[model samples]
Target: MSRVVLRRCIVRGRIQPARTSDVRAPGPRATAPNSRDGATPRHSASHDNRSRTEVPMVSSSVGGVKSPRFFYGWVIIACVWVANFVTVSINPLVFAFFLDSMSVDLDVKRSTLVWGITIRMISGGLFAPYLGRIVDRHGTRWPGAVAGLVVGLVLIGFAFTSNIWIMFGLFFISGLTGFSIFGGNMLTMVPPASWFVAKRGRALSIATSGQLFGTATFAIAAALLIEAFGWRWAWAIFGIVAIVGVVPPYALLMRRRPEDMGLLPDGATSLPVVEVTSAVASPTPTAPVASATHREEPDFTVAEAWRTPVLWANLAATTLLMVAISPFLLFRNHYWTTLGFSPTLIAIGVALDPFSFAIANIAMGFFAERVPIRFTGVIGGVWRGFGMLPLTLGMTWPGSVVLHNVVWGIGSGTTSVFQTMMIPDYFGRTNQGAIRGSITPIMVTVSALGAPLGGYLLDAGVSYIAFFWGIFLAVTVASASFFFQKPPKHAPAATDPPTRMPTST
Candidate 1:
């Protein structure tokens, strides 16, 4: 008779067996029990005339031991921070400074100039659903890298274009490519949501604080460049920075999820394991199993999320707030100039807005970890509404200018973090991009109206003060809407376990 020895090892979440050479044995061959009975085989040295032996089962490093190295998720966060800092600046942040200069150079109304942004928004909104699906399926690296390259080139195009139509066309292209790919919530916000579950609030806040930091830093930089070399050259300089800052980091460093690297979310060091029973009178190997804890996260698909009332309520609130705020933001510099502030002072003021925003964003991020995000949204909306009151006071007290921005910045920063975290927190990460993208058209359509409407109203002799008051009213309503939002429930199939709703916090 011949005896066979078998060894089992765990590799990449699976159990596989390795066979060793057969050995000669006396009498009847010893047989092992079936694995399904959950019984261990026994051997007697006297009966079988064979020596007892112990076999070691090999386990994957991810399952066997914890690594002490720094988590790669933080690295992803840093890369996203850099990407956001550069990419977001080129559009609304630094681009705001270029509006007056571009209007003058292109011989167009400021209203006409801002239509470029409106067009960009519409086009980006149209493209968002597809981009979301791509991010969900393929990951962020290629899409982000391509977007950075296109946006950089578009900025360069803006530097040389004298035709307003051509400029609008360029804006349209940017919307389809750059903004759709890496700008706003897609690249900057989504990755952090997928990478960390427990630390999501802080992670997203830190990642997105780049927007405020970039706004503050680049507002000053854009001002100096516009003053020194004129707006065309300033745009040219920004284009170069965009290419350098955005392209390399995303291409080399960005990953879709922590699982791709054989790591768990929130820097969890050990992989979950299930014991395997073998019949060969040898040690059994353990195989990696999906974490039961992680599966509890709510994974509402796009269609399912759309059916929930909370989604609609949140979207409605978001839409109203954006519609109210967008025009004010578009016309802020122009309105301040009318109040007799110097360009230098206006530049300093603009820088101050986001500096305050950065401070509040980090602070609120910590607060969000312990509180339900809806409450933060409510507080932010009410605070921002009051912040508008200071603006209605006009330059009557120049100090009011400082007060309005600081208050508005803190409110906006708090609200921004709330908005970014809400969707992922309510819906699981698996299909979040698609769920978020589905709402883009509604948000973009209403928000896009702001710039053009503000331009038209100003041309028709409506006072900026009236617009400020209207925003205050709109924000109040939106704040009240936040009280109605709640986490949505999903109907699971018969075979699926009942889904657990995340704690309200």
Candidate 2:
């Protein structure tokens, strides 16, 4: 009978047994060369055999099969793409179409209606930290699925609600579920970030670009539905779409981390090996190996990351961007309408915006892989700032509407990629959910004021032209802050022991 020899090896950063057959029967223990003494006695056969038979490590692939050519990470990205499309389309994107109709039907001030968005933001912001911890402890699957259900139901509830307070309650629920988990970039962004490290920027770009396409698709669809059926029916239909698109894919396909699946990030096929010493064998230390294409990132705890200035800078810039962009998105259609642009022209502008956004997104994906994220953010902000200049001309220049959308779309697309990548890139993915969640409250507190503030300003006779100029200023400041956001140096705590790879001699 062949003798089985078991040695411990590190595979893809996890400890597992490497078994090999030896023809020789058990005999005197062999002596291995030791660095200090030149020879060391091996453990007895009983010790070796007992350790070998205790537990069998599960193989990542069955029957020694190679990993598939297609990476499962891309499948995860696809699910995120679908989730982004449905979640965003049902809320802020499509909600713009319903604003006027809902305001008129419910007999509420436009600002009162817009307060729904503010409530959603505030509620989401409050829930984010707790949700982040949950995501860290658990995974995105159940949370995402449940959030999708709540979002879908919330949209459907909008159909039956006439009381503004009830609408506010629904908005609160939607914010807590949809805004925090699915639509607000947490669940959608975190999955791809967790899945791919080297290809993170590109992956996030592809994942978030779904919002642009969803915008293009749903804008026209919303207009058509509102024209044919009414705003109430349109809300009901989008509810159905959100449910159908978001739930199954997230529940079925989502996973926590690549390590959990015995896989490496970015679909890397080769397993890194690290040697560990045991009592039975002489010390044969080996450094942890990583794939050529993969760069191992430093893991920082949330508490540690908070000590760095980069996180605060990014937080400031993100908050400013939200303040500028949120109102612009919420008021785009309304602003154009007030300028005497026809409904059809406004609809065309809304639909065409995503095309430019898609082009910029694809371009940014390429650049993000090669360039500094700070540079990309700076450029996007400047481009977006200039884009607002078109709106200053207003109805006198009929083409200004489309020009603004196109130019701003490109800028927004570029910034979107940068925003998704910045935190994870600097902080690493170990505590990503908690870290991102921790900052959401600050961002939401400031940005949540945009919609209602815009409505109030406009209602108080503040010129939309002046409002646009103010947004340009905010964009300028936000973009400038990115220059200060270099990656933070990680300092490992003294008490924390370094992870050691398990090995058998």
Candidate 3:
């Protein structure tokens, strides 16, 4: 003979009733679900009558797993990596690969065809502010998905268009969406910044380094595709990849901020709320008191940040870098072709660039926190100047080309990492997206002129030496400017929030 009894059972912060025998003591961690499919067994008399306490069952999600064991932020990094990897293949890198073929097929001069790319660059610059504002206002998931679609469709459209005017229009639309910065670029950088403070440099570097991987893999793939199929088919294939490859990851894994995951930045347990008050003193005032308290720094408005010196300095440095690098991006393949390298060899050399970029990117991320970002820019700038000058050496030796890619890749790597880290380090993360957005147009506008300017010079019969030498001089001056850059003083003073573990919710 047995009597039934209802006992209190607490599971996943919810209290219910069960037979006293079915309950088990709470262990170090919740017990695994009893069912083979990893579901919690319903509390019932028939299932278990011998146990006297309730066993805490681990929570299961859609995939039949408990909560993620690793930091969710790294998951964000991985998703962004894939997004950049697929999206970039349709942009100018691959376009550069297809330039000569497209011009010949369309019966257009090389200089005239270059305008399509120029249009895209200018459109990206013009639209950046608006898109950046959208990112700051909205979350990244939808914009990234939509942009992926736009870029994919545009690439497919490019395959069918032979008219120069239509090419310009297609490129313009793609620039508005295909360029990562205007589309989902901010999503990748901003989310990571929101999730980390002390380790932000490393996190940002790791995420942005995805560009290197995309460049390495996609450049080789694009060259190979163009070799096997016609240029039009190459564009079509890249388009399909962009549409299929980019959107799913963001839809599933992308999180806008750490709080969404019930976590704090850098795996913090609690967010700090700091209070700053002005104390009147005759000689000097003491720093704000932030003792044993969670405090947030004062967020600067976009207008306020614009009034600072640091913003302008960053704008100038980045814009100059764009001017220096733009020509190479547009003409690197053509430059190699003229140097007597086969398309396959050129592809191999270009693929090697990312390996160099990856090394510098990771190294910079690891050390960025330890060093002044301005110095990082200086090092990158000096390296770029020398790296660019070598392409003018006219060495047909394969080693010279490889050497050029390695030096330039390593040098250019730090430039991007510094640009990203500088914004948050100088200004707090509160308005990071907006500040970066405002600075973007200035850089892109300068870069937009770079390719056309190079084309014009080439049209006038100027040698690659002339173009490379001019860029080298410009880069040297830009590198020297980093030494004069100081953190913004005009904006509201903000201190780093104290680190503390979050309280268990």
Q: What local lDDT does model 1 show for residue 432?
A: 86
Candidate 2 colliding pairs? none
Q: Put down candidate 1 lDDT per residue, 284-385, tens digits, no spaces.
A: 322222222222255678987898898899888888877777778778778877878777877787788888888888888878766677777887887787
> What do the candidate models score in CA lDDT, each in turn?
0.70, 0.72, 0.66
Query: What digit string (tens of lDDT, one per residue) describes model 3 on residues 1-505?
Result: 2222322221222122324444344432222331111212122112122322222222333222224456687887787777777877755565678778888899987778878767887787777777777766776778878877888999899899978898789888987863554322575677777767657778888887777888888888887888789888988998898888767877777777765666555654322221112222223212211111212222456887788776787688667767766666778778778878887777777877777877897788877766667777888887777677557666777677778888888887876667777766666666777877777767776777777888888889888877777778888888888867765443223342223333322
Best by lDDT: 2
Overall local distance difference test of candidate 1? 0.70
**Model 1 stretches with alpha carbons more than 4 Å out:** 1-60, 64-68, 178-184, 273-295, 495-505
Lowest summed-lDDT stretch of 10 residues in model 3?
35-44
Count of clashing pairs, candidate 2: 0
Residue 336, candidate 1: C-alpha displacement in angstroms: 1.3
After the best TM-score superposition of candidate 3, give how far the Cα of residue 60 lies from its true spot, in angstroms: 22
